[model samples]
Target: SGAPGSRVLITTRNVNVSRTSGVSEANMYQLSCLSDEDSWSLFKQRAFSGKSSDDYPELVPIGWKIVRKCKGLPLAVKTMASLLFCEFNKDKWEDILRSELWELTEGKDKILPSLKLSYHHLPSHIKPCFAYCAIFGKGHVFDKDRLVEMWMAQDSITTTARQCKEDVGRRYFEDLLQRSFFQKSRYFDSFVMHDLIHDLAMFICSGDCCEVVDGKLSSTSRVRHLLCRNERDFRRLLSCGCTDDLLKSSRTCYCVGDSMEPDDVDGAFFMKAMEGMFMKMKYLRVLHFLCIPEITELPDSLGNLKHLRYLHIYASGLTTLPESVGNLLNLQTLRVETPELNGLPRRLKDLVHLRHLCITGDFLGLTDSMGNLHNLRTLEVQSDKLNDLPESL
Candidate 1:
């Protein structure tokens, strides 16, 4: 596609990817750390923006020391600079330069010390919101509203008397965005964390959040958040040697699937495994399944998750909710997106605390008792079969 003499440049953290692309060792180039002068220049540009370094003569010495600790890594330098951009305090700069986090030795594939310090410097309330992001995989695109709703479901947002939870959650997202923790995704209305930033989140959330991939769990610790990258990983987690206590301790479980749809046998296995898992995970606060494509029905035992607050399913084959769904007195948000679903549970009206309900299907089965859902605030239905609205609604 290029002129004969034109050269293609490829950059990647994984050497395997480079080799796989047919780049030989003779042609490969490993980047070295930047020189001291370059590092300082980059740091000064970010930390001072357009202002001259002379504007803050007192902090330049401390800034140089901090930049030296970054070892010429651009991301580390920029993150530390952003962390101190507006600060004019000498003591604050000195404190950052002398922090013990820098003394921590680097581990294989571990996050940079500067990134760790950036997370450490986050506000207390925003800390949990950021750490909770570890539940997602690297390169994951985040939806602002969906993430805010998830944070709300987890009680991560603290709202004032005048501000609603979504408003406060948006503020938290913007704060992170300003801090360079989240970058705008190429997709519209979405964002993504830099790979190193994602690593920092995973490192800080170590024991509390666990991710499963290729049938392997990142950690066996007692985790509150669990993520399965695909249906196979979820199945492996259910059938693997993981203890029942571990499942019982999880408060959030998210499963994301690829494009491949499951066969009849795989669907049956998935249903059986889900039933077994539902029986064990009693404390689950949020349950999400995206693109799994074979969930035709929910197990009755789902009602046993008395503490569940958020439930989301986006499978093409999902048909209906079990009647026991009404037992979730504390449930707040429910989102089911599928064209195959027939209707809602008849007892859904009993969930007085339900606030958000979104459904996409052929039949909604709305009843007069829907008026009992007095706390509902957001309602979205995508259906063509229904021609009339319930008077109670």
Candidate 2:
């Protein structure tokens, strides 16, 4: 056997740090959010296992939403899971879900702390990397080495890099990670913003340091939408002229080894990342993701929006849906094209105010009490796969 000194295996959320003085690594693994079934089951076990059958079926679904938002981060699930043990109704779960990072962790310093606490945990050198992210948009993912280079260029690191640059910045980044300030997105070695934590960053950037730092764009800058599906796509996003709307970008990069891969910004799944917004942001009356495909899910929160009249999710991967989707009482037109849809949510029966429902593909089951919605003027799903036509129709 070769000397053990020739190889060493180290695991870290950051890809940049994995590259060494003269060694290449293989078989790196990246993790994504849990499947809906697994997430729902996990939430049910910890949040509702003790409840009686007579009281659960109605409330269990709501718990599933909370788990989905946690994005399968065990740190987040367990922290909130234990806290949820004190509540009795769905409102409490919503309150927890709707809360900002500070709200959940406030006063519970023994349990969690405010940004000051999260910030305080960072070592002297790496504080800038966390703060440096303020330059990127909230929910934006960054290439690890590129970002680390920028962080090193910052005054904080240059002041310290001479002594031991890599270790200094890395230690700070790890500190921020330990304190739960930043999360690693699996596709590349990049970090992503969870909504609440991003809210915290935006809150900070909007406060005394608004001009100096912004985790999100401010009114001062023009809004633009950038959609990139590859590194060439990223270059395309940056190359476009500035505007005032939303700037979306997606990029797929190829690296010879794991150490060089960027995180979070998955070119393949970027469309799913944008699906929820397409349905909800009424301010965004006009939308488009025609450039790419591979999206599969929609955000259930969009159903509560009363002004929304037009919805479209015709992507190939959109095979399942949320039961909360039944609440779209105001929807006037719905369109989709998914080949593997197994069934419609039972709650679809509640949409009595609908006018047009157009699904042009196959589904395993499309019949149930849902046909009772007499208000339907047009229903156009594939007929071949229909398990049964509702007599009530």
Candidate 3:
């Protein structure tokens, strides 16, 4: 399907899948557990949230005992360490050291019982937020602020009248980060969930969230959140008999083309599919597009998404946002990262409810009406053509 000498890389836990795919044994690779030294280093980094292990000499021995029980499994060690975070008492550490959860045999695909214990201990409000991440595929890199904004769009963050939702969302993100639910990615300012942790999230939200890969939908009737990994997956979604009703109930939809190759689908067909899909997802709260190089512009019908709160387009070929985008009265976050982009729509200044705006492109400057965005909390812009800030800002 690709040009001569092209290769496809596949990652999986099942050896049989690889063998069935015709991968030669000589080309196969197996990953082993972390070395004890590396495991301890990772554990200390998470458990103390950067505090030195020597400072808590008394707890060091108990920590090693807990780490040893983890069998050099990074996720297991981090889970147990996070559970012991901020606990100075020796008995508490010992209790976790002897938790019955560790005694349970590893389940299918090696879903460690320690991971389940970590999820069980998550705050009630944070549980759904974590589970909602099941919509993302394994190996997907996460943006901290973007993830929090999506949570706010879904009403996953709890806040009082005096508290700002953004603040609350940030707190929730930090809590998850500290608990090992998220780990830093090799890419700067990004995070990734361990494959095992991703599996746990999928298990937690199996009833409502669905992921479509290689044109296969896991669930249709009760699905509320959907992830379409490529053009084939999106096409499959459009051709599904229950599309209209399914789109109506969907709260979040992520169409990720980052993994797409140029030969995967014709550009025109992909755009046409996207335009048609947008018109049907009336109640969507969060919409994300990544590395969709064929997307030069968004459909005007995108503005019809009245309930949309978070919108992100990254590493795309987008040149301009439609003026109708301002019609999204509930939109809270808008991030566009594309060097090809020329400018923002003038009506963008009318989004009074917008809280975060990040743009990176060739734009010269912003419209003076930016002062109208009273609720704005974070503004980031990177442009070689930009000279000065608007007085209204």
The lDDT for every candidate, in the order shown, is 0.85, 0.49, 0.83
Off by over 4 Å in 1: 1-10, 35-45, 49-54, 160-162, 259-264, 290-294, 364-368, 386-393
- Looking at model 1, which ten-residue stretch has the lowest summed lDDT? 257-266
Query: What is candidate 2's lDDT per residue for 208-305, written digit by digit as tens?
Result: 12221112223343322222223324323323332323322101111110111244345444444334333334332112122223335555654644
User: For model 1, what is the alpha-carbon lDDT of residue 179?
Assistant: 80
Give the runs in model 2 whose Cα sits over 4 Å from its true position. Answer: 1-272, 275-280, 283-293
lDDT score, candidate 3, position 387: 97
lDDT of 1 at 79: 88
* Residue 127 lDDT in candidate 2: 54
Supply every candidate's count of residue pairs whose N, Cα or C atoms clash at under 3 angstroms.
Answer: 0, 21, 0
Residue 124's lDDT in candidate 3:
96
What would the TM-score be for candidate 1 when compared with the true structure?
Answer: 0.88
The digit string of per-residue lDDT tens for model 1 on 261-353 reads 345237676677778888899999999975456668888998989989999988787788899999998888999898998889999998998
Tens-digit lDDT track for model 3 on 1-393?
799999999888799999999999999999898887888887888787678989989888888877787888867887878877876788877777777877888766466888877787788999999998887888889888788899999989898899988788889888888888888999999999988899889888865888786666788567889888765576566556446787788888887754467676566766666677778889999988664577788778888899999998775588988999989999999988899889999889878999999999998889899999999999999999999999998
Q: If scored against the real structure, what TM-score would every candidate get?
A: 0.88, 0.32, 0.79
Question: Order of all candidates by TM-score, from best down to worst?
Answer: 1, 3, 2
